[model samples]
Target: MKNRTAVIDLGTNTFNLIIAEKNEGALNELVHLEEGVKLGEGGINKGNIQEAAFLRGMQMMKHFSGLLKKYEVSNYKAIATSAIRNAKNGPDFIKQVKVQTGIVIESINGQKEAEYIYGGVKSSGALSDKTSLILDIGGGSVECILCNHSELFWKESFEIGAARLMDIFHKEDPIPSEKITELNRYLEEKLEPLFEQCKIFKPHNLIGSAGAFDTFVEMIETEKGNDVDLRELKTYLFDSIAFAEITDWLCTSSHEQRINRKSIIPLRVDMIVTASILTGFIIEKLGVKEIGMSAYSMKEGILSKLIR
Candidate 1:
């Protein structure tokens, strides 16, 4: 507890907690946990946290507080992202969370969120000398960073997260072809800014940071019967062909089918389809030829800052 530090990322769809400490001159992670609290489940698009979700968030904070105590973590930071920042009642919710669990929530805007995401991806060593586009798809927003190994060139956070998309375009069980078409069309319009940046940077490698990317890496590994211990690696290389195939499968699968898959977590079962569609859209529209997955993301990025 003396030297250890922890960071919590309160995303729209999930709450992530990571505890880490430096050992023998190297940083090591003690624990990383993600809880599907769905804080913005019923009222995200409406710019509010429903009564039930508000109460639910309080419970999760108390639970997370217990974990922090169990791990003897005294130094910790809790970051609230799109869900809380964009919601009309976000500040009130944050206040209640502090009062309930003694955890102060630092809410951040989209731009700052994108910057943190860049830092997280940079730590993974996924960015190369050449240029890479990093995409982090959360529940309330999607962050796209255009950068490379040495520096981050540009970044923007768009409010088209998987959960947001689910609320907008999820009209059928399997998502009809027309609905897919409509969703893609809508995304094309909203992501124009990112596409413009891509043109200037001409990034060929698309790096996905945490969340759905983690699931993709595991799902692909499981598909190939390769039991690669993800903990040992900072980044996982993705074959474009394999990724495309998986994207197609994911976009067409039903909730029941997705729920049965061990790689697809219960929290992501309903939103993965939209997330996959968004990733696929980016890969195709931006002409990205290579894909890489970073196991580190916002929480990991902030943990570094906390330790500093």
Candidate 2:
């Protein structure tokens, strides 16, 4: 039997599992699964994972452990980011996972998380000599990396994620324009480091890693009636004009309208509006010439290291 490895990403909003077998020095993907645990649901922004979210995360981890056993995985790594890392009960949760499931969960810092995400996107071969700004928006935090094809220039992780933003600024169902303005101001304040870095490095293109970008691509494809295979796509070029249109709709649409859309997943319905706003804010702030999406993210980044 070949070596099979499993990688579990315990994200703030979703827990993702990827099983792959090493074949002739490369990783051949065998399984991919995602469970929306919403670990940041109740009070993650307040530095705590609420009781319900904690229980949900535990259940999801147990389920992922079962999948790892079913695949007879020889090596496995589980990582917790953002919500778990920032929460006061984070270490307790990690201990419970190890004691109950015998799976040790590593809680990584934002800077390290950005590094792994960069590794994943770099593996996609979408990058070039020109500096590209890579963005991975998770539930509790957003990882930003500036890099060319060869080396990393600068990287930072912001805690102003969709979940945090939703909790703070999304009191209204369809967020009020004033609230949007406030959110923009908040982003500008929090993202000053990124802005300063952008001034120096001057990354030309925005490369969005998984999560929200996936939904954006799906929504755009549904609207255009295009059948692009996302799994096979190394990188997707997103039209900035079309993205602006989508963001506008998301910001102005009600809960009923958003949830009814086939392209919006149930788990993402509440948070996508904030996500769209954040993406739009970044694009405008950076003055990016183009946008691209990479389906690969943290899991792939881990797999690349493991296989090597």
What are the per-residue Cα lDDT tens digits for candidate 2 across 185-206? 9999999999999999999899
Off by over 4 Å in 2: none
Q: How close is candidate 2 to the true structure, as a TM-score?
A: 0.97
Q: 9 in model 2: Cα distance from truth in Å?
A: 0.5
lDDT value, residue 226 of candidate 1: 78
| Candidate of highest TM-score | 2
Backbone clashes for every candidate come to 0, 0
* Model 2 / residue 77 / CA error / Å: 1.1
Q: Each prediction's Cα lDDT score?
A: 0.88, 0.90
lDDT of 1 by residue, 59-98 (tens): 9899989888888887998999988998999999999988
